[model samples]
Target: MTAIRANSLRNGPDEQGRFGIYGGRFVAETLMPLILDLEKAYRAAQVDPAFQAQVKDLGEHYTGRPSPLYFAERLTAQLGGARVYFKREELNHTGSHKLNNCIGQILLAQRMGKTRIIAETGAGQHGVATATVCARFGLPCTIFMGATDVKRQWPNVLRMKMLGAEVRPVTSGAGTLKDAMNEALRDWVTNVETTYYLIGTAAGPHPYPEMVRNFQSVIGEEIKAQFFEAEGKLPDAVVACVGGGSNAIGTFHAFLDDPSVRLYGAEAGGHGIDVENGHAASMTGGRPGVLHGNRTYLLQDADGQILEGHSISAGLDYPGVGPEHSYLHDTKRVTYVPITDNEALEAFQLCTKLEGIIPALESAHGLAEVIKLAPTMKKDETIVLCLSGRGDKDVESVGRYLGLIE
Candidate 1:
């Protein structure tokens, strides 16, 4: 393996947690001290051997670390070009990469003596993951989900309740991920003394954006090791779907400094990026702005008011993207693209049929981009897509959309 370059792209957020012009703690004054305390606690835990040990142990025994990196033989032949591989995060406990961050944050909460946990989820994978860890640790968890998501992602809502989490459906604005986040932040600010907001993605305030990325970085680390074992070298590319961009940042973190590995992030292009309020492709269709405690690309109007973003996959409809993604786009280190709803739906069926692996609709966005990209590369080249979640939670909604169910 080659050593990381001297001026590595992996080093970021600086001291104030600003990644270039993006990412910073822009929040209400009432929440400042709480954010600071969380930052301090996180820093101390970063070097605490016992804390790190607990995270590692839980990941291995509970969440199932070292998710496989499997070569997609049929997919490669179908593409008729670059070899395709999948980093099977869907096989992890709770069926998504969300569990990786949830496990670490729950441990941190325990260390901080937090008794109540709260979170915001779009696709509901993060909510279920958070609720699962809370049940294991015996802490009360409250999840805020957009009303639309609560209706569409009922399976996950049921799973969270089964794990003992109270699901609060937010109805304001678009009834989507952005509104759910607003409610979560309000709850955090109101109950700052007793509550810990376990953010589900690599976005939000200073410490959260960086902290979540650190926790999820295991995906990329494991991918590199597993790929070396299988192919004896680095992959030519890495791809992932980006909502608030947790999984994308997770798998991209380890490859940021590798000049040879091209990184691609697929955003939800609901209908199309050009269609007003018809897509959630913040990076591709929106511009820089602040929302949910950080500066990033957001879908907004001329007055700078946040606009409702759309996506068939509930998770990828957030109006703003993770701040790190904004920085990556500006630096030209990663290519950000949009995948329309129809394209994603087609890719969803293709993957399930060809691989017998049902992918979350959110994951299908990444696969959709891979379908377009893989065929363009050399046959000797290799590409690994982060299959972020399984499709069980999405089967019902997708079935309705596909006209397979009444």
Candidate 2:
């Protein structure tokens, strides 16, 4: 066990948005004015009581705040060591924690008087969440998705369409999340005046990683209160799967000041880290580089070209992670582990059978880590992992993988 350390880990992302050389406003000069405007608007919103009230009200009513913290009795017994608990973000509206960021951003966009909206999605949960909010707010929206993801994640594509968002399949390199983000950035650059780019993850230019994390921090805030109410103390560990690290940072931020609580982030290892470019475990097998906007760990070749990392979960297919995650990883505030597709698959079935809860493949990666570490800890210790999203969107892809369907 680690001893309690001093200094608050929560106060991060200093003035220029650099999280200890990990994050910054690394964007084109053409976008500087727009980025600055966004930063100003976000800063103003931070101190506005009315804005905060609206965000909280929508969170509670529209997106369903305070998602239950359910004790996983069967899972705990099966692991036979640490007690297990699930922070049920999958029960939120749009079937994932993505809505938490979407709700706050959409409201912020309204405050800025932006009428058109656009976003990029990997596994489609973010697209669905963005589209759902745009529809609720009566804004015209478009979503960029990789062609590969558009096919594998057809159900989510349909969900976005049903919510009245135009889906554009990006057929660029890898045709995955990175490509989708590239396309989204291009759209933002072209239509910066009236279009509000709603980045789905916390890996974009300055203010975005910071803004999204602030909105999603509600996850940890509620977990703190709920866990205290249930067990009268904090969880020994807090774990979540990391794509661009929004959910992981959200769950880790509240307890940053409480050094006694250990934090873990599970990254997608499509096959294994030993297999070059075969995994999406950025922190485990990546070098620091700039991608999208901020400087962070990126899957890149020796020549500095970004590599296409593989993962069974489309949501975890990103080549880079959020900058704060990079800082956390460097500072040893959070332990990062790579979970292969096979491991996630096994963990998915185990959780489904034992707890009767089908988790998103992204969530499954975190579950895989929990399953491994839980059995090694004392029986009284507690481990709480984020059930980031429900498994409904992934049933078809998983069924095909297991040969349960044609």
**Candidate number with greatest lDDT:** 1
TM-score of 1: 0.98
lDDT value, candidate 1, whole model: 0.94
The TM-scores, one per candidate, come to 0.98, 0.98
- Lowest summed lDDT across 10 adjacent residues in model 1 is found at 1-10
Which candidate tops TM-score?
Answer: 1
Query: What lDDT score goes with residue 51 in model 1?
Result: 91
In model 1, the clashing pairs are none
In order, candidate lDDTs are: 0.94, 0.93
Residue 88 displacement in candidate 1 (angstroms): 0.3
TM-score of predicted structure 2: 0.98
Off by over 4 Å in 2: 1-6
lDDT of candidate 2?
0.93
